[model samples]
Target: MNKETNYQKALHCYIQASLNILNHFRSSVKEIHHIGSTSIEHMDLPGEVDVLLLVKDEGDLSKLADHVRGVGYDEVEDFSTGYIEEVVLRHRYDGYDVNFIMMHHKSKRKDEILYCRNRLQGSEKYLERFRQLKAAYQNEHINGDEYQVKKSDLFSSVMNMQGDADVV
Candidate 1:
């Protein structure tokens, strides 16, 4: 199939996955956003979706963990930004790998996450830079962690340039 066909398929799968999660946690979540490369238009990605789930209260973290686990999402990790907590869960939905990131509504990390996503969405220059990085990572065949670190570094640099503190 052609690249556009592949991208269309991936985008469809991503949206379906997002809807499934949104429906599952309709009452528990404050907001849900499509983040990461899959959310960016024309960005080439394997069928994976990054979802950001904001909860109304901090106490909802454990409840969400249980809720997601009951529905087949495995707890990927528990991470934080010193003052705020974030939980990551992963599951396969409709042939798409979905990374569900849950955080409290008050977490400052949310701003950073949205900012990075919006930056990529708003600027072809930033998007092209990210694409180049992804290409080089694929060419080198590095592990996923290494690729994440490189992406984080690139994002951190961008955030710093805008006078924001480094997030990753």
Candidate 2:
């Protein structure tokens, strides 16, 4: 199948899975958000859709996991933090893979979120540099292995320039 068709199918499956989970815990979940590459527009061959289901209390997590299993999703594993528990689910449909990650409200990492948002919204120069590197890698204009090495250096340089390393 063509790339576009594949992406559309993946998106459909993601939305369905998300809705299923949401309906299962409509009363307990405070919010459900679609994050990561799949949520970004024009992204082709995305690894997988990352869904964050935020609940108000940690005790509600087990109920959410049970609800997901009841909806035909196999429970892959559980990830825990001091304030929340994340239940991971994986299922396949028509050779496509879908993943669901249910997290509690307290699990939200504010620092990481803010850092990523800042990087994406930073100065034009940084954005342009990132775009160029991305285009090179996407267009196969450079060796993948070489790009990986250079990309790390690019990130380090950008971080240093922004003094992000000093930020707590």
Candidate 3:
């Protein structure tokens, strides 16, 4: 399939997954967001959809995961950073990946949802810098070695901007 078709398929999977979660666990989840590269338009395939599942409490995280799995998503792995539980799921039909991150109401880590949204709303200079870096990296304007260096720098700059926000 073409890149556009693949992206649409992935997006459909994301919508389905979000609806499924909301239908089953609406009370526990405070917010469900579609984040990461796929959330940004005109970007190449990032191969997965990153979801941020914010909840009022962390005690019901396992229940949430079970509900997601019950809806035909297979759990691939789980990660915990003392503040949140990150549950990775892969859809059986399309193999599209989704991350169900369970975050407590109180956490110091930068909020992924706010970070992504803020970055997108950042100044034109910041956006232009990112665009130039992305284009150069994608088009092989810079060699492989230079691409890695430049990519890291670009990412750090974006992260720094996002980090300035209050996470709550």
Best by TM-score: 1
Query: lDDT (CA) for every model shown?
Result: 0.73, 0.59, 0.62
Q: Order the candidates by lDDT, highest first.
A: 1, 3, 2
Q: Is candidate 2 or candidate 3 better by TM-score?
A: 3
Q: Residue 79 of model 3: what lDDT?
A: 28
Residues 80-125, candidate 2: write the lDDT tens digits: 2221345777667545456666666766453343344355445467
Q: Write the per-residue lDDT of candidate 1 for residues 1-168, one digit (tens) a residue.
A: 545654566667767876787687777788878777777766775546778888888888789778889988887763323224578888886677777888887777888888877766666777888877777766777766677777878787656555334433
Candidate 3 lowest-lDDT run of ten: 77-86
- The candidate 1 region of ten consecutive residues with least summed lDDT is 76-85
As for model 3, its CA RMSD to the true structure in angstroms is 5.7
Off by over 4 Å in 3: 1-9, 44-46, 78-85, 92-95, 110-113, 120-154, 162-168
Q: Candidate 3: lDDT of 40? A: 57
- The Cα RMSD of model 1 versus the native structure comes to 4.1
